[model samples]
Target: MRKLIPLLLLVVHHFASAQTKDERVKIDSILSVYTGRSVDGKGLLQEAITLSQQSDDYLLGQLYFKLAEEHLATGAYDSAGKYYPLSLTPLEIAGDSTLLGEAYIGMGYVLYLKGDYTQSLNYNLKAEKIFRAAKANKLLGRALKRMAGVFIAMKDYGTSEKYLSEALTIAEEEFDTINIVRTLNTLSVIYDETGDFKKVDPILKRAIALAEAIHCIRCMAISYSQWGISLHFRGQYKEAIGKYRKEYELNKLEGLTFDQYFVYQNIAEAYFELQNLTLALAYSDSAMFLAKTENAPQFIHDSYKIQYKIYKAQNNLGKALAALEMKSQYVDTLFSQEKARMQEDMKVAYETEKKEQLITLLEKENTIKVLEAEQSKQLRLYLIVVVVLLVLAAGVLFSRYRLKQRTAKLLDAKNIDLQNLNQVKDRLFAIISHDLKSPLSSFHTVTSTLNQYYGQISQADIKKYLEKLEVASKSLEDQMKNLLEWSLHQISERKLSPEVFDLKEMAETLKSFFQLSLEVKRQNMYLEIEGSIPLETDREYVQTILRNLISNAIKFTPPEGTIWLRAKTAGAEIVIEIEDTGIGIASEDFSKLFTLEADKKSIGNSPEKGTGLGLVLVKEMIEKMGGTISLASELNKGTTFTLKMTGKQQKQAA
Candidate 1:
C-alpha cells in the first residue's frame, strides 16, 4: 500500500506539470496576437493574466510585462509603472534573466519620464548588466542608449556620448542599422548642443542615409529635422526650408500628425528668416492648429512666438500683441506643468524612501526579537521615528534644491529663446530693408532725373531715362511675382491644373516672351522639340518654371552667347533642358543655386542683378507639377538646367 501511494503521487505530479506547460503555450499564443497592437487588448491580456497566474512564473511575468507595454503605449504611464514592477518578482522566480532585464528597462523608462534620473539610471544599469551577461547585444545596446538618454536629460553630454559611442559600436558590429542610425542621431544632437556643428553635419548625413537605406521613414524624418535645425541655426534659411519640407513630406506620408506640427513650425521660422511673411504666417497657423488639437502647451507657445514675429513684421501691432498674450498664457501653463512634475517626482522619492525604511526596520526588528524582546520593541520604535525624521528633512532639502535648479534652468532657457528671437528679428529686418529699399531707391533715382531735367535733356537722353525707368519697373514686378508665387506654393493653395500642352508651342511662347530681353542681351535662342511632345501638367506652373530658367540663362549669358531650349519624349516622361553657352556656375556653387543664400553669392562671371528668388521659385513650381529639375554646370564653360515631367500618354494610361 505504501509503494502504490508513492507511485500515485508521482503520476499526479507529471499530470500537473503537463497541464501547466499546455496553459503556458495558450498564454503565449494570446500574447503573440495582441502585443504591440493599438487596439484595446487590455481585456484579452487580463484573461491571459488570469490563466498565467497558476502557470509557470515566466509566463505570468511576460503577461504582466506585455500589459505594462500596452499601457505605456497609450500614455497611461501610472498603470505602466505599477505593472512593470509586478513583473519583476515572478520573472526572478522563474530565473528568466532576459525578461527580467526587459522589465527593468521598462521601469527605467517610466522613471526617466517622471524626471527621476537617478533611479532611472540605476534601473537601466541593472538591465545593462543582465543583458551583457546573457550576450544579448541588441538589448544591451538598447539599455546603453537608455542610460545615455538619462544622462543627456541631466545635461551630462560627455557621459551620454560615452554610452552612445559604445552602443553605436555594438550596433555596427551586430549590423543593426536601425540602432546605428538612432545612435548617430543622438550623437549628432550632442554635437549640436556643444556647438560642434562641423561634426554634426556628417553624422546627420550618415544617419539620414542609413535610415533611407533601411526604409525607416520615422528615422529619416527625425534625421532631416535635426539637419534642418542645424542649417537654420547657421542662417541658411533656404536650405533649411528644403530639409524641413522633406521631413514634412515623410511625416505626412506616415500620417504622423504630431511630428508635422513641429515641421510646420520649423518651416515657418525658415520662411520668417527669408522675409517671406505670407508663408511664415501660413505655416505658423498650421502649427498652431495642430498644437491646439494635440493639447500641447509647449508647441502652442512656440507657434504663438512665430505668429507674433510674423504679425509684427506685417505691422499688425494688435495681432502681434494678441499673439504675445497667448504665448504668455502657454508659458504659464508650461511652467505650472513643470512644477507639478517636480512635485510628483519628490513625492515618489519620498514614498520610495519610506517603504525602504519600513522594510529595513522590519528586518532589524525580526533580528533583534530573536535575541531580545524588550530591546527589539524599543529599538524598532526609535529607528522608525529617526528614519521618518531624517527622510522628511532630506525630502525638504531635495525639494528646495530641485526648485532652485528648475528656476535656473527655466531662466536659462528663456534667455536663450529671447536671444534667438532677437537674432531672427534682426536678420528679417535687415533682409527686408536691404531688398525692398534697393528697388525703391532705383525707382526714385530714375524718376527724379527725368522730372528735374525734362527741358534740359535731349531726346536721346530722355529715351535712355525712360528706358531705365522701365527696367526698374520690370525688376520690381519680377521680384513681386516670385515672392507671391513662392508663398502660394508653400501654403499649398496653388493647386495643379493639369492639361495637355504641346511642348514646341510652349517653347515658342516662352521664346516670344523673352524676345526683348534676348535682343538687349545680344543672345540667340534656339528651340528643339521631338515630334510634338505632349506633356500633361499644370501649364502655368510649367510656364513659370521655364520663364524663370530662361530669364536666368539670359541674365548670366554674355553678349553673343547662345541659349538652347530642347524637349523630347523619354520613355513615359518628357525631358526639357535649358542650356546656356555663357559663363557657367562653379561646381561648388551648385548647392547654392536653388537656395535663398544664392542671393548672397554671384554664381557666374557676368555681373547680373538677381535676388536668386527666380531659381527658388522655379524649383518650387517644378516640384508642384510632379517634375524634377537638375543642373550641370562648369566654371568657364556653361550651365544646363534639365526638367523631367510625365507625358500626356503616360498620365492617360495611368
Candidate 2:
C-alpha cells in the first residue's frame, strides 16, 4: 500500500506540472499575438477563436464565447451576437452547462440593446433555466436583474417587482452590493408610481449610499436620476434639478447622447417652473439639438413643449401655437416609435420561443440515446445500470426544469416592468389626446372665435369674452405646468436657490388662493403658526409646494372636512404639517408611493386629479431644502402630509 501511494503522488505531481505548462503556453500565445500599441480587440478575438480551435480543442467553445462577449462590450453587437450562438453549438454538444448558459445570456443582452427585446428575453430565459437546473443561484440572480429591466420596458410592473425583489434577496444572501443597488433603482420607480414615497425615498437613499461607497459613477448616475425624478414628483424641484445636473455633468462623455438628452429636457422644465425662462429656453435648445442629432422622438416632443412655453411667456402667441403644433406632431411621432418597439418585441419573443423549443428537442434526443444504452445493459448489470441512468436523467431533467422555471420568472418580471412603461405611454397619450389637446385646441378655437366676432360683437361683449378668455388662458397655463413638471422630473435634479423668508406669510397666501375652493367644499381651513416662522427658503418654491399640498387636501376632502396646516418650532426644525380629512390610501399602496418607475400606476382623488407626482415632488423639494415630509393616512379617514424644513440649512450641500 505504501509503495502504491508513492507512485500515485508522483503521477499527480507530473500531471499538475504539465497542466501548469499548458496554461502558461496558452497565456503566452495570446499575449504574444495581441501585445503592442497597435493591438486590436477584433484581431485578438479572431486569432483566439482560430487558435482555440487548433489547440486543446476543449477550450475552443469557451474561447469563442469569450471573444463574442468582448465584442459585445465594445458595441460590436453584430459580431458578438453571431459568434456567441456559434460557441453555443459546441457547448451544447460538450454539455458545458456553465459556458452554454453564459453565452446565451450574453447574446440576449446584446440582442436587447439592438432593439430586439424579445430575442434578448428568450435567450435570457434559456440561460436562466440552465442555471436553475444547475442550482447556480449567483448566475440566476444576474439573469433575474437583467430580466427585470426588460420587464419594465414591457409594462409588466408586478412581475418586474417580483424579479427585482427576488434578485435583491439573492444579492443580500450573497452579499452582492452591486446587484442590490441595481435592483433598488429599478424597484424605486415602481414605488414612486403607486405613491409609495416612503419606500421610494429610502431605497433611493440606500442605492445612492451604496453607489457612492463603491464609487460606481454609472450606478450613481442612475440613483441620482431616480432620486431626482422622485424629488421632482414630490415637488422638490431644487433637489431634483441638482440631481439631473449632476447626471448631465457625469454623462457628458462620448456615446452618452441618450442620457444627456433626457437631462437637458428635465433641466428645461425645472428652469421654466422656477420662472427662469432664459435658463429654461437654453436647456430647451440643448434638448432640441440632441433630439435632432440622435433622432429621439421623445426628446423632440419635450423640446417643442418648452419652445411653446417660451414663446407664450414672451407673448409671441403665433410662435407659441406653432411650437404647440410642432409638439403635437412629435407626440404623435413618439407614440408610433413606442408602437414599433412593442411590435418588434412581440415578434422577436415569438421567434425565440420557437428556436428554444428546437434546442430542447435536440437536448432530449441526446438524453434519450444515453437512456437507451443504459437500459439495454441491465439485469444484475441491468439493475445497476438502470439506477445510474435514472439518477442521471432525474438530475438533468430537474436542472432543465428549474432553469425553465427561472427563465419564466425572469420573463414575468420583464413583463411587469413593461406594463409600467406602457402606463407612461398610455398616460402620455391621455395627456395629449384628452388633457392638453382639449385645452390647446380650445385656445386656438377661442382666439379664432373672438377674431370672427370682432366687427359684429359689442365692445362690452368683447371685454367680457376677453375676461373669459383670460380665465381659459389660466387653465391652459396650468395644463402646461403638468407637461413642464413631467419634463423636469424626467430630465433634471435639485437646483434650489434658497433665501430668507417668512413661512407664515406664505401659508396665509396659500390659504387665500384656496378661499373659493374651501367655500365650494364647505371645508374649514386653519393655519397655525405660534410665532414668526422665518427661515431661509425660496419663495416661489415654497408657494408652489404649499399650494399643491393644501389644494390637494381641499380638493380630496368631503364637504366640511377640516384642514389643519400648522407650522411651529421643534428644536431647530420648522415643521409644517398639512393634515386633512380626505379619502385615505390603501395599505397595499404604501410600498410604491414614490416609485416613478414605468411599472407604477398613478392614482389621485376627486375634482383635483393629480400628476401622482405632487407628493413625490413635495418630498424631494423639502428634503433638498434640508427638510423632510411624512404621510399619516387612513382610508376614508383623512390624510396628513408634514413638511419639516431645517432652520439653518446650508447653501451648497446639494
Candidate 3:
C-alpha cells in the first residue's frame, strides 16, 4: 500500500501537467463552435497566442485577423483597426488573396464598429476588390451585402437596397438558398419600416415557406413571427394571437425562454385588445415577470404599459396610478444607466486627451530647442551673410517643391476615391435594375399560374405549387426584414407593437402544410393539444419560434425519425414539449444551443446560410411573449424541447 501511494502521487503530478494542455484544447474547441460571432473568434485567437510561443507556426496571421474580428464585434474600434493593418502585412507576405480579403473585411467591420461609415465602405470595397480578383463571386456578394448592412446602419437606405438587391442576384445564381432567405428578410423589414404593408405580407409568407422547406426551424419561426407582428399592425389581432401561441409552444419546447417570453407577452396584449380582461391581466403578469427575469428593458417597458392600461380599464384608480409611477421609475433607471455609462466614457476620453496634449507640448518644445541650437551654429557662420541668405532661399524653394509634390499626390488619391465611389454607384444601379425584375417576375408567375390553371389544376397540384411559391415568397419577405432591420439599426428608430392574436393554429396549420414532407421522411410529427390554448401576442413572432423548432427537428432527423409535440398546463404555466428521434445534441453543445449570449452560431447543419442571429432573435421575441424555453439532447439519440409560458392557456389546461 505504501509503494502504491508513491506511484499514485507521481501519476497525479503527471496528470496535473497534462491538465493545462487539456484546458487549452477545451478553449480551442469552444472557439471552433462559436465561429458565427466575431467575439468568440478573437478570444480563441488570444488563447492560441498565449498557449503557443511566437516561433510556433499555428497560422499566426490568421489568429491576428480573428483577434481583429473579435475586437471589431465588441466595438473595440481602435484596437481592431491597429491589429487589422498588422494582420494584413503578414497576409501580404504570404500572398494569399483569400486571407487578404478576410483582413480587409476585418478592417471594414472595425471601421463600421467605430461609426466610420464612409471609411468602412472604402474598406469593404477593398475586400470586394480582392474577392472579385480571385473570382470568388460568392464572397464578393457577401462583402457587398455586409456593406449594405453598414449603409443601412448609416441610414443610407437607398444605397442599402441597391447593395442587397445585387447580393440577392448573386446568391440566386449560385443557388444559395440561405443567402436568398437572408436578403428577403432584410428587404421585408425595409418595406415594413417604410410602411409598404402591401409588399411585406407576401414577402414574409414566402420567407416562412422557404425556412420550412429547408428544415431551418428558426428561420421559419422568424418569418412566422414577423408575419404575426405585421398582421397585428394591420389590426388582425385574432390572426396575430394564433401565430404567437404557436411560437410560444415551439419556443417552450426548445427551452428558448426569451422567445417563450414574447409569445406570452403578446398573447396578453391580444387578449386585452379583444377586451378579455381576465386573460389579458394574466398574460401581462407573465410578460412582466419574464421581462424582469431576463433583464430586458424594452420588453419590461412593454409589460408596464400593458399593466397600466389594464388597470385603467378596470377603473382601479389606485393601481392605475401606481402603474404609472412604476413606469416612471423604470424609465428613470434605464436613463440613469445610460447616463452613467456615457459619463464614464467621457471621463476616460478627457484623461486620454489631456495626456496626449501634454505629450504634444513637450515634443514641440524639444523641436524648438533643436531649432535654436541650429540657429546659433548658423550665427557663428554669419561672416558669409550672402551664403546664409542663399541657403534660406534654396531651403524655401525645396520646401515649396515638396509641398507641390504632396498636393499632386493628394489629388491623385482623391481621384481614385472618386472613381471608387462612381463604381459603387454604378454597381448599385445595376443591382437595383436586375433585382426589381425578379420579384415582379415571381409575382407575375404566381398570378398567371393561379389564373391560368384555376380550373385545370388539381387540388394536390395547387397545394404543391402554393408550397413552392410560399418558399419563394419567403425569400423576398426575408430580404425586406433584413433591409428594414438594417435601416432601423442605422437610425435607431425603434418601435414595439403591443398587439395580440392566437398563434397556435398557425403553427398547427404549418405542420399540416409540411405533412407530405414529414411523411416522406417517415417522421411521425404529432401535436398533442391539451386545450384551446389562446394567447395574446404577435402571431408572426410566435410563428417564428415554432417554425424554427419544427424545421430544426426535420433537418437533423434521418429517415423514419419520430417527432412528438405536446402542450399542457402545470400550475400557472402552459408547457409544450417537442421530442424528436433524430441527431441529438451532445452534452457539451447543450448550453451553447440554449445560451443566447454565447458566440455559437449555426454551422454546416444550418441550411439557411445565416449569421446565427435568428436564434437570438427567436430567444428575444419569445421572452417578449413572456415564456420560458429549454432543450434536452443526447449524441446520436434525439432531442426533446420544452416551452413554458404564462397565459390563459393555463386556465384552460386546469
TM-score of 1: 0.48
**Candidate 1 on 1-654: residue-level lDDT in tens?**
233333433322333446567877887788778847547687678678765544544676788898888878877675577668767866775678998999999999998997999999999999999999999999999999999999988989999999999999999999999999989988987886677888988899899989989899999999999899888877799999999999999998888988899889989988998999999999999999999998989999889878877886786755865776677667668766756754564464455446545644654454444434447665564444445434534644464456457545755775675566555445434545666566778899978988898899999998888787777777776765665566435434356756788778989988999899899878899998776777777777888888888888887888889999998888988889999987887778788877775564455557656677788888877775678899998876789999987864222110
Candidate numbers sorted by TM-score from highest down: 1, 2, 3
Top model by TM-score, which number?
Answer: 1
Model 2 TM: 0.43
Candidate maximizing lDDT: 1
* Model 1 alpha-carbon drift over 4 Å, by segment: 1-29, 50-56, 273-275, 292-298, 312-315, 324-654
Q: Is candidate 1 or candidate 3 better by TM-score?
A: 1
lDDT (CA) for every model shown? 0.77, 0.69, 0.64
**Candidate 2: tens digits of C-alpha lDDT, residues 1-654:** 233333433322332435445654775587567533233755665555543332332365666676777767765564465557557655764678977889888988877776678888899899889988998888999899878778777667788899888889998898888888988988998777656888987898898889888877788888888888888877778888999988877677434657788898887877777878888888889889988988877778768977887877776656765786577567657656645644453454345445544544544455455445655542243334334434534544454445346445645665665565556556555555555555566568768888887888888887877765765665566555545445343333235666788888888887887787688669999988887878776665677678778867876899989999998989987778889989876666665665444223345345434334555656666665667777888888988887877766554423
Lowest summed lDDT across 10 adjacent residues in model 1 is found at: 3-12
Candidates sorted by lDDT, descending order? 1, 2, 3
